[model samples]
Structure formats: C-alpha cells, structure tokens
Target: MMRTIMAIVAAGLAAVAVQAAGPGFDPRALKAVAGPPNEVMVLGTPHLSGWPKDFDAKALGPLIDRLAAWKPQSIAVESLSGLQCDALRRAPFRYAETVETYCWDATPARQATGLDVPAATAEVERRLAAWPERPTASDRRHMAALFLAAEDQGSALVQWLRLDGADRHAGDGLDTVLVARLETLRQRRNEEFLIAAPLAARLGLERLEPMDDHSADRPYRNAEEEKAAGAAIMKAWDNAATARRKAADAALQSGIKTGAGVLALYRAYNAPEQAQTIYDSDFGAALKEPSPERFGRGYAGYWEVRNLRMAANIRDVFAAAPGQRMLVIVGASHKFYLQAYLDMMHDVRLVDTDAVLR
Candidate 1:
C-alpha cells in the first residue's frame, strides 16, 4: 500500500511539472512581429486631495514640465468616464453606492445645454470628428460646455485651460453658472484637475480620457460583516511593513514645499521596490488574514477586479490608434497592477517611469 501511494504522488508531481512547462500563448512574444509598438508610461501619484490644505499647486511644476517633454499623444486620468457613470446610475440595484460615491450629477449642466448624458456624449463625438486644425475661442467654449453637460469635468477643464483667459467667460453655450463651475474646477486640488488637465492643455491635446472603474464596488452583507471585515483588514495592516510604508510617506510629504521635493516624492512612489512594499503592507497582508469569513480575500479580489477593469478601460482608449504614446496617471497602489496587465498587450512597450522622471 505504501509503495502504491508513493508512486501515485510521484505521478501527480510529474503531471504538475508538465503542465507548468506546457506551450503557452504570450502576447508579449508577438511584439517583435507587430507594427510600431505603443509606448505607455504609468505614473503613480498620491491623490492630491489627501494632501494638506496648504499645499500649493505650483509645487507640481517641475513634474509637469518633465511629463510635457515626453509629449504623450494621449493622457488617461483616474476618473470615471461620464458614460460609465451614466450606466451606473441606471443600475441602482447593483451600483447605488458606487454611483453615489463617484458619479457627478450633471443636472445643472444638462439644464444649461438641453442635452442629457447620451446626447451630450454623442454631440462631443460629432464635434471632435469635425474638429478643425485651428478651433476658435468660441469653438473651445462650446466644447467645454458640451463636456460639462456630458459630466466630464476633466475634459471640460482641458478646453477651459487651452483657451486664452479673455475667452474663458459665459458665452457660446456656457452660462454664467457653468463658467463659475469651470473656475471652481480649475482651483480644485485633485490631480485630474491640477496635473492631467493642465498637461493635456499644454501638450495641445483635445481631451483627457477617464479610465477609472468602480464596477466591482459592492456593499457588505450586514453591519456585523462590515465591521468584522474592517477590523480584520486593520489588524493585518498593523505589521512592520505598514509602519515602514507610513514612515516613508510621511518623510516624503514633509518635503513637498518645493517642486524638487514634490518630484522626489513622486520618484519614491514609483520606485521599482514599491510594488513589493505595497503588497507586503496592504494586499499581501489582507490575503493572509485568519478570518473565517475570508473578508481579506474578498477585499483583495475586489482590488484586483478594479485594477483589471481600469487596465481594460485604458487599453480601449488607445486601441483604435495603434502605436500612440500614452500616459496614465493613477494612484500609486495601482501602478504595479496596471503595468503588469498592460505589459501583456501584444504591441505595448512600457516606458520606465524612473527614466521619464529623470
């Protein structure tokens, strides 16, 4: 009986080894045979909204300068597209919380333009299809209003910023209220507003693509489950790795008074080692929690799904324009997953974030 069992185990091991070494289809292997490969730079950023109220937008100038030099043909920000938000609104049963948390109400803009989300989105496509080589200030103002009606504040800001200051007033489909809103968005602390929009305008790009995803968001079964899951995850995060991460972030943030300091913070956030550090402190720890409910696994699963969807959204943006240079600005934790997923594309060539920064 012992001899038979040993033989069975050996056969199982051999089968596993064979499976691991079997023929595989890797899209990356097709890169050499493809046309000019798409160049992608994934920039990991700390959400500017989380920074101190005293933080100055000018501190980002150096970082913006470097990115502008790279001259990406397309830019993707970590924002939910107006179309996605519209879909979420229709499925309140599954996405009520997500819609509430992430979707902007376009009622004001809708009232201003007499166009709903779908209508406004279609109008945007039509206008861009016929967009001129040199659009007038009036044309820009109209496009900005259309973007607002479509619930795409980031793209609206891109148009607003590209215009001369004299042209950024209430006219050409923009009412006084909508103009005020655009001004407010200009002063917003979010990275999409402060960094991505300005960079797109500076680079002479027409629009910024919103690639964030919240489709995986779901409510807990009950208050008890929610509390239990939160506690378990917190417990997992109380290890030495968490402490080290926090310490490093605090140190970097303390030096953000200067542009060089801000650049340094970005450098640290995008360092190659950050992937392992983040996994150790957050996802890896949650994955190993000892909860019977497997709450940690649930959290990790949601995270992976969200990242995968974000990657897909990004891919969809450059799909029609092969070999386009693209820049993705997202939260630091998402950098590793986005790079890994995007690197699997047949024609994508990942640019070194560190090299770009330098």
Candidate 2:
C-alpha cells in the first residue's frame, strides 16, 4: 500500500512538471515580431431579422457610419461559404438539417450563368484577378451575376448595391429573374444585407467574406436524445444570468428606433462586460448542467468547435495580406468566443469595439 501511494505521488509530481512546462511554444510571445500585425474588430449584434417589423433599416446608418470610419479593408459576416454548403449538400445524412437551415439554392443563378458552385467560384476569382480599377456598369452587373452563381448572395448584393440605380438591371448574365431576386435581397431584413454588404460597398471592398462554420453541427442520434438534450439546455438557461441578459436586451432593443438608439444598442452589445454575461448565461451554464448524457457539455463543445473554425476562417482572410484591417460582424453570443480564439494568433491585434462605437 505504501509503495502504491509513493507511485501515485510520483505520478502527480510528473504531471505537475509537465503542466508547468506547457507545450514549449507560445504564439502570443511572437506578437508581430516579423512585420505589422493584422487588426481585427469584432462587432457583436442582435439578429436584425428578429426585430419588430416597424424597425427601420435606416436606423443602422450611425452604426454603419462608425464602422465605415474605421475603414476595414475586409468585412467578414457570420455566413457559411458556398463551398462548405455544397459539401454539406452532398452528405445529407450528417448535414441535411444544417443545409436545409443555412444553405440557399443557387439553381437560378446556375441556370443564368451556366456555372455550378465550383465553376462560378472559379469564375469570380478569374474576373477579379484582372478587374479594372474603373469598371463599367456592365462589369458590375456581370460580377454580381457571378457572385449569385457562386451562391454568395452577400457579395452579389455588394456588387449590385455598388452599381448606380439605373445600372441595376437585367444584362450581362443577370436575367430578369435574377434582377428581381437582387431587388428582393436589397429589401431583406438580414444583417448581412443591411450592414455587412452595404458597408463593404461603401468601403469600396469587392467582396464580403462569409466565415461562419456549421460543419461541426452534430445531428442527434434519435428523437429521444434530441428532446432530452433540448430540455437539459433550456433548463440550464433558466438561471439568473440568462434572465438578466434577456432584460438587458429588451431594454436595448426598445430604443432601437433611431440612429443614436441603434448606436447605443451596438455599444451595449460589444461592451467588455458582455463577454462574461454571454458566457455565464449560455455556455457556462450549459457546461455545468447535470445531465447523465452530458448534453450540456456536448453543446458547449460544439460551440467551441464552431467558434474555433470561425476564427480560423477569419484568420485566413489575412494570410495573403497580413497587415490589413478586418471587420467581423456576428451574433452577440459568438463575439466573446471569437475574440478569445482570435486573440491567440501571433499576428492578430484585436481592436476595442467601444473605441469605434464611441
């Protein structure tokens, strides 16, 4: 018994020594040792689609103006890329629900441009490679059509919005049907359409990056498991922190009828304190729930995997051009996770959202 105890104590000391040594490499220590590091600003937002029907899109002007003033060379929105959607489409067994919920049908654009997702994606790259500094109306129209064909509606809308009012018509691969679709997208109540696409157009950016990842979505093994997991998570969320967050959101959203109100709402969403609030209310609660199947832990693990992949996607935008500024607009719950994941990169410098909102 004494020998076994000694062995256990020795093992504990070895574990401590390993923990103290770490992985022997720290990316944060590099800290822009090579050149100018990339600057990233993450803006946490409530889903505009959930707002009251009376909510005016114009209320976003002040918020947009402030983001525009920051002058991010690239804007990333919480949207899955067409390529990933295509992959998910092929494997419906694992991702049928995800594809149904998040992916759009590109068949119309495919028919208009005679290009599938992959071909259209390549065509978009080819056109941009030799795109003129001063492109014609026809050029914008053609590019918009290509973006639609690529299943990148956000970028397509950016191209469409960039065109003059008279120039937004059916031509250059954009059929009458496609033109109408663009017009419909223009009036949609989505943040990607109202905020990111418009901001990209205003900033003269050619495209908006869709960096959201749903590949980590785990389909439940059965209806029983799904129901139980849902119940567990909902029960976990019925806590004081979640209540406080809901109240705070209600207060902010109540004043979202004007530009200043919108700015204030955004400021509150991106405040430093929000990070802890979000974690405590959602993931943290989920992490501590007592479920035999560990449903809460599964939910928390999925959240982390999704955020890590999203951070990787955002980081990829600056791989070719390291020093550029990037603006990432995503749901409020994701803001803290994204920032925490991104802050670990060797060449990433996180910008304070409060400073920009101020």
Candidate 3:
C-alpha cells in the first residue's frame, strides 16, 4: 500500500513537470506586444564582463540595441533600496552596485583601490588557466559551481574551504592556489544554491535591483534571544542539508543528465519556492540574517512559503494595476519556477527571458 501511494504521488509529480515545461510554449508568445503585456519582462542577464571568445560585447551589442529599441517604460535594476533611495530621476545608475561593473572590466573599484585593474579581475582566469585542456563536462560544471560560489560567499569561500579540509596549496603563486583551493571548497560545499539568485538577475528583462537586505549582525540588544535564535537556525540548516543530500542522491539515481534536468529534479523534489524563501528569509535583531530553515532556521523561515508569497505578491501587484507593462527583476534560478507559478494564473502573458537576452 505504501509503495502504491508513493507511485501515485510520483506519477502526479511527473504530470506536473510535463505540464510545466513541455508543449504549449509558443515562440510567437515571445514577441513584443503592442505594449507590455500583463506580465513583466524577465531577462536572464550575465553579470560577468568577459565571455568566452564567442560571447564578447561586440557579439552582445546587437542584443542590447534590440532591448533598448523595445523601450521598456523603466528598466528596473537589482539595487538595494537604501542604495537607490534617491529620486528615480536622480538615480545615477540603472544596475545595482553589485552588478555595476558589467559593461567593462573592474573600472572604478580597481582604480580607486589602486589595485591592478586586470589583477583585480576574478580569479576565474587563474581557474581557467589551472584547468586541464579540454575539460570534461563534469569539470566545467564543477568549475562553474566554484566560480559562482566564490562570488556568492565572497571571501568566505576561502575560509570555509579550509574548514572543509581541502588542502591549501602553498607553493608558488599561492594566491592562485588559494583561489583554486577556495573554488574547490565551494564545489564541495554546494554552490548551486548561490547561482539561482544571480541567474534570475541575468534573465530579468531590465537591470537588476536588490530586492532584499543581506546585512550581518552588529551589537545586539538581546544577546540571549540572539543565541537561542542562532541555535534554532543552525538546526534548520542541518535539516536542509540532509534533505539536499537525499535530493542529490535521488537525482543521480534517476539519471538526471542535463543541468535543466538537475534543476527540475531540484524543483520537483526540493521545492525551489521554499529554497528561495531561505534566500530571502530575514531574522530580527535576535536572529540576524537569512538562514536555511531546514538546516538552521535561524531567521530565514521555510523558503517554499516565502517564494509563494513573493509570487503571489508579484501576481497581485500586476493584477492590481492592469494593462501596465511591468518588468520584475528576480534571480535567474527563480525564472523557471516563477514561470510555473505565473502559468497557473489567468489573464497573464509570460515572456521568455531567452528572447530578450539573445
């Protein structure tokens, strides 16, 4: 009886997946409307400056021009509210401070810091250099995860790697070795969790904006409550890690070969909406920051619930103000999942991020 119930549940999930991704995806639906449709343009944009030889700015100029020609009412960016507190007309930049360096290589940051402009470039170069020629798909996948982790965790990537027991190479060019070690650590620690947010930013039609505040703790008024909250959060993370491991194992067993397949497995089994809530979760003075509730639940509650709220808010906001061309800039990882949510709603037209980005 248990097996039968499990089989039926699995069958239902498979049906949902097919309905979400397969068929009914009309290419014509991607075209620009007489005006912006009820839906916002979700563009998957790349924050990195350099693309492999085939993906240079010269290659992207035409695409940028096309988007500009489309003339969005406003190009919503991924900036923190505080950073963009200035009046909209007075706002100097459209892109968030986090993504400000997209067009050119490290410009003002490098120059102001007096660091070699190229030297300050992300060690992706070093990683690319250290890699074996003609890296396998797994190697590329691992590297991608590492690079992304380094970006997400910032300096924590290196520190956490050492904790993970990956040997720190201490030979010549220690910086490169350290970077590699950190990347390896990120790889081990599960960096895909970090990529979804950036991925969403890239796909959103307009510039990105910081939708959440991710500040760390300062002197707390209530230390006891803080400690208790911290403990609770840690416990939640432990649970999430367990679930994530089970999900990974299931994916491997299921022969989920491609990235999309893995993501689908992640969504179907782990529930991305919940995962995103973990990302956006906030703790009060006692808790501090977003915590993966399953593992630690510090301040960030269940992501599934938060994602649902965000989607509903987005949907309602659109519905509340009808006939307006709205562009919602969210993380790329949320792209597919949000589309699934949007699809379930009525009087809405979903625009493909691919059409806008390409």
Best by TM-score: 2
TM-score for each of the candidates: 0.95, 0.97, 0.31
Model 1 lDDT per residue over 32-65, tens place:
7457778999999999999999999999999999
When summed lDDT is taken over every stretch of 10 residues in candidate 2, the lowest stretch is 28-37
Q: Which of 1 and 2 is ahead in TM-score?
A: 2
Output the worst ten-in-a-row residue range by lDDT, candidate 3. 189-198
Task: List, residue by residue over 229-249, the lDDT tens digit for candidate 2.
Answer: 999999999999999999988
Q: How many backbone clashes does candidate 2 have?
A: 0
lDDT of 3 by residue, 137-169 (tens): 344333333332333222223223322233433
lDDT of 3 at 218: 25
lDDT for each candidate structure:
0.93, 0.93, 0.40
User: Relative to the unseen true structure, what is the C-alpha lDDT of residue 170 in candidate 2, on a scale of 0 to 100?
Assistant: 96
TM-score ranking from best to worst? 2, 1, 3
What are the candidates' C-alpha RMSDs?
Answer: 1.9, 1.3, 18.7
